[model samples]
Target: MNLPATYEYYAVIPHRTQPAVLLLHTENGWSLPCWQTTERHFWQTCDHINQTIQDLLALRVITLRCLFINQDTGSGHFIRVYEFENRDAQWRPPVNGSWIGFSEFKTLPLTHQMQRAVLEAWFTEQMEGIPTTRRAWARTGWFDETARWIVEILQGQAIEVSEAVQQVRTWERSCLLRVATTYGQVYCKAVPAMFAHELPLTQHLDVHWPSHAPSVLAVNRQQSLLLLRNFGGPKLGERGIFAWWEEAVHTFAMLQRETVTHADSLIAMGCPTRTLDDLIEDIRALLADTETLFVGGKGLTNSEIAALRPHLSHFLNLCQELKTYQIPYALEHGDFGPANVAWVEQRPLFFDWSDSSVAHPFFSLCLFPEEMEISFPDTSDWQMRQRSAYLRPWVCYESLERLTRAFEIAQRLAPLHHASRYHRFILPHMEAKWEMTLMIPAYLRCLL
Candidate 1:
């Protein structure tokens, strides 16, 4: 859809020391999914970020989108991006031609002329195969090329060993990159696994929850690269981090509903009755690898681990109990926790669906109160402790009370909200805990 012509694309000149806003003109309209629009509305509702954006635009920090069209040497079509030098409230002339592709180049100082040359050469390399053109590249695939160029830029930075990484903090995961040409932000992510699957999976999930997800901007699966919306949020355990327990519960409920519907569709498409079981087995296989469970953390000794066994065992029992009941299997946001959630615009955005799966309800909730309490004990405070203690027991008690108060106002209105099936999954986990707890005391004694 053509946005109103009044909207224009603008790129931000990254501050040498601080984060800055990247703005693109929205009057011409941008291609964003309905959900993203909803998310923006949420942002608009929650705070003055939109107003701040306007102020930034007034100060010349943000501008319109620059559409780069390639026409000279032909390998189809691509777009290039150039950041305007620091200016205030005025449209600057485009200094560089839009090349083969565009990505939010990193904010390195280009400290010296050599660095500038390197960046210039990198840009040149991207434009190498493409012919120059006067008109904007009309192709729909410009996004993909933009992603590729960004990856090359970051990867190229890796080769310049003379630059100390100390000043340049390298993120293990991809960084969020914003181009001046688009109103939306894109994630510069290198897929850990087959990157190709990441975009498709994200696209599928986006389609499923169109109202709650960021659209995939681009992908280069072959290079394990992706450029998608950066759903910004506070990190888990950080001060001022957002937590929406109610929203978390609600989203999961919606997911469960969707799972049933999706499963039925899959079955109609010829999926076998054993599909659920097979899926569970696959999940088990993934977890069976002790290394996978470690998640790159330091090894816990058998003794130190033994000390935590009772609590861990208890936690396991709860999972098993719920699993035994089968917990009404549905698609689970496998790593559902604070880290995976962003409090944007007063709503909880459940993210990092990389580990998502169809599992028992409590399986996902494992990452919630109890599991987090155990793993991040040092980080827990009085309030966190209270909430962690309160939430699960509250859920359990409420579910148990459901049978007694089937006709109660709260229970009737939210019947499925406290699914008693939680006990099924909890029971099996409880059983596992029973075994671990028994072994732990002996193991601890041996270690001592």
Candidate 2:
């Protein structure tokens, strides 16, 4: 019987009377390895075949009696073909010879391996022969919703999603897929080798944030797929440095109180040791003068962002000058900034709890425009100028009156909050790298 030009078909020849299935490429008339040639026939037993048949049957396919046939290897192969038949003795035959012995080949399931292969193939095809807009996947609108998104990934249920035209990245190291599904949106960040270790950390943070952040919808532990709630907002980086600075201080204060309250609980649960002094030093170091530091390569001129180093130093110095050790308790947002906070309905929602740590409240206060300048030098000058205008006065205060007030209040706290889980967030480079260490001193000079 002749197969239709439009439809693809496969045929199976049994081996040593073993069951087999054959696949054919209709366009090229090329035959794919049938079941007889695959490891399935050699490693899988007849019982496995029966089980497969049963599973296929559950999928609405009918299995007929197994048969045996000869192969090119001079071996007998056993095979089975699912045919049109009813257990209750029902049969429907085609009226014409055009539709002879009837049956359709089953399509293979698209496993993760298959998806990766397809992606690679597509990428190769698109890039190999012709050159098009290399910027097809150029992305924008990278706003930080770390805190809110973390919550969403942990506790979010299935909800309708909005459509977005997002570019896809295919490199194995940074493979990512963002699609607008009927259920809000799906962003799959694939960290090839570390999915197992990273997935749980994300899930833990998601499930833990029941009240503060967005809910997590699902988690594919094996694939490191974090299905989270899409909290659309401006990242701290995009909010203009000045705006981020104001929000950082307030958020840090609130988070500090929460951190202290939860400190004892976290410590009891095996959390790491965190100290205020350690945090102060870390901020000081990050604000120190450094050369050729990269801030996601945003490319802003040195003058436009030169205030970063001095600004950070000034923040630390102010804390020191005010003698605000009253901030006895410490809890850090692990990684704090406007990127982690979302302005939802006029209220700021903190997110990205995965990096939560125990540090001084002022740790977040370092989120001033100057700090942003240092972190993201590639930012546009207009934005930097706008940020400088907003912060220039605030940084020039004669006294640390407002900052002192905050420290006085924070000192009343009894303990500090830090992660107690096996998962931790310390980057080795932060401690050993000299360039990163100087971020604080440079920023402190801004205030003077």
Candidate 3:
């Protein structure tokens, strides 16, 4: 049979295919691997695949190498081929599938092509590339519910979802979904019940600052759902800082300046306030915490945290000195990155506000040069450029010396959060955390 010109089809041939029928050995036969499909991206299709191979199949794979991947745009089907090789002698497949070889599998009622697709995807060593997913196979838990929720929201719409999937970064605590419909595509975001505030917060921004944010199409604050019309822009690249960063940061600075009057609206929505004033109390609380530091912090039972208790006053003094800079605080994006942005035409949109809080503007810089440089090695001094650009507007508001001091202080204090996390210069072993032993006085002596 000739495959359609619109779609391509390929086979996932095993390394050496004398294929096998992977019986689920269940009373009912819902465990067939044929359920696997393109919707799985990297075959993280169902939660059972991993456990079935490990616990049920009793096989430990040495590698899941990708043999090849061929696609047919005409049929909208991608044939991802692969093989799973066992290198250990102790590994043995379950007895239930003992007779699942290609010869035995053909005896089943399934057509030849259907049977082959199952064997190829199951035993493949590994897919060459796996798309990003949050909490591996989240569909196993809340996916069905999420689908129903979307369907219920769009029940009256004159469109059908051709495809839908959720992509989330391992570090993020939110779900970003992409849904392709007969008409076009739309995006959806799901946050925790506590973070449902994002629903109203985003909608408010969309109304008041639509140029910088995506408009909400539908929402269910109770479920923490926020649906947005896809802005139809390519996502910013993962590696390297680009001109978009400058534009976004500039827009952020502008937003923060204008939003100060609207702070009540945001604060009511649960954004945290951690300005320098707040830091004063936060520091004193930590000084108070020194009495119990070892009980809470990691690696502290080693006697190092105990030695730093006497220096609490010194740290407190530095915290007090930070007030002298008088740099104004503003809305801070706790975990900003390129992935959170999408451009609509020439306009750049900053999103993924899950970690946002109210803090010193420079506090946002914590993730810039340091964390961003890690992701984009070629990022160079993009942080410095952004820092200057972000601070440029506030130039007439404060002296350069004070702003510089505030920026430096934010560098040291930006990471201060939670009593349980390891704090630098508060312990003798702090050197191990940031290698600050030699430069300890350089960072902290000014406070003394």
Error of 2 at 362 (Å): 1.6
TM-scores, all candidates, are 0.39, 0.37, 0.57
For candidate 3, lDDT tens digit of each residue in 7-27?
222222222334443343444
Residue lDDT tens for model 1, 337-445: 6667666666556666544444433345542554355544566473343343323333432463441232122112111121211112221233112212222223123
RMSD list, candidates in order? 19.2, 19.4, 14.3
- Rank candidates, TM-score, best first: 3, 1, 2
Per-model lDDT: 0.36, 0.38, 0.52
lDDT, candidate 2, 1-448, per-residue tens: 5422221111222111212222323343323222322333421123243334334333111122112222223333333221111222222222210111112222332222322233233234334632332211111112123223433543354443354323243221233445575655556554433223344444543455444455556655554455555666665566554544454455445545655666665544433444645435544444342332333332223553474444555445544544443444444554555666776544456665444444454444343434556755676573434333333333333235554454333322211112111112332312212313223223333333
Query: How are the candidates ranked when ordered by lDDT, highest leading?
Result: 3, 2, 1
Number of clashing residue pairs, candidate 1: 50
Of the candidates numbered 2 and 3, which has the greater TM-score value?
Answer: 3
